[model samples]
Target: MKTILLPLLIGLMLVGCSSSPSLSNSSSLYQELNGQSGLERLVDAFIQEIAGDEQIFHYFAKSNVDRFREGFITHLCDVSDGPCEYQGDNMIDIHTGMKINEADFNRVVELLINAMEAEGIPYRTQNKLLARLAPLRPEIIHR
Candidate 1:
């Protein structure tokens, strides 16, 4: 009886595992944003907007815009559940010495939202991405 029940249980487990959905093929926020190329364009637009904004432009004045743009794209891709990995420093390590305050962080978020809108990404999708990024505030602000 024990041997028979064990085999039955094993078969049931295998069936359940095989019927489960594959997360890799699932529709992600990354796909919704049109994948890597779309993310690159969105990052470019966001960086441009940041450069022009008086409130946050000073933060980037001494930084490498091109490198930042690339890292930003990679970071956003990772955040949006894309296949790309981010090669840049983590949020706390990168922003530790920057002394970014709440207002500055908020301004950056606003600029990003505007940039997404300009790129024709829908509002719900923008919010989804923003929600994923919102957790980084502690590592980014007042640091």
Candidate 2:
């Protein structure tokens, strides 16, 4: 009975696995982003974008640029499956008191998109990276 059940379950699992198209391999997204130096450039560009935006600049006015830069670089790297681990505060903890509204949060996203464009990341790759990071929205926007 045990042997028969095991084979039956394995067959069902194999059928289920093969039923859907597999997603693209995401492990190398870090390399696609051009690795460490590219991530640094992205962070720097994002910072500059935030600095230049009137509405969004105020949110980062009192924040330390160096801290933000390093933390963001690490976070991006980790999310893209790079070698670095994120060592910064969790998103919720860092954004809890910010009272960030949806519009402002979206503006920040737009700034990030702009930064990716500046870094010459292809549109499809940008979408891939954005999808990887999209789960952080709830943690960041605390109403």
TM-score of each predicted structure versus truth: 0.80, 0.80
Model 1 root-mean-square deviation = 6.7
> lDDT per residue, candidate 2, 23-76, as tens digits?
455348888899999999999999999999999999899999999999999998
- How well does candidate 2 score on lDDT at residue 110? 98
Cα shift from native, residue 45, model 1 (Å): 0.7
After superposition, candidate 1 runs with Cα above 4 Å error: 1-26
Specify the poorest-scoring 10-residue window by lDDT in model 2. 19-28
- The backbone clash count of each candidate, in order, is 1, 0
Clash pairs of candidate 2?
none
* Model 1, residue pairs in steric clash: 99-143
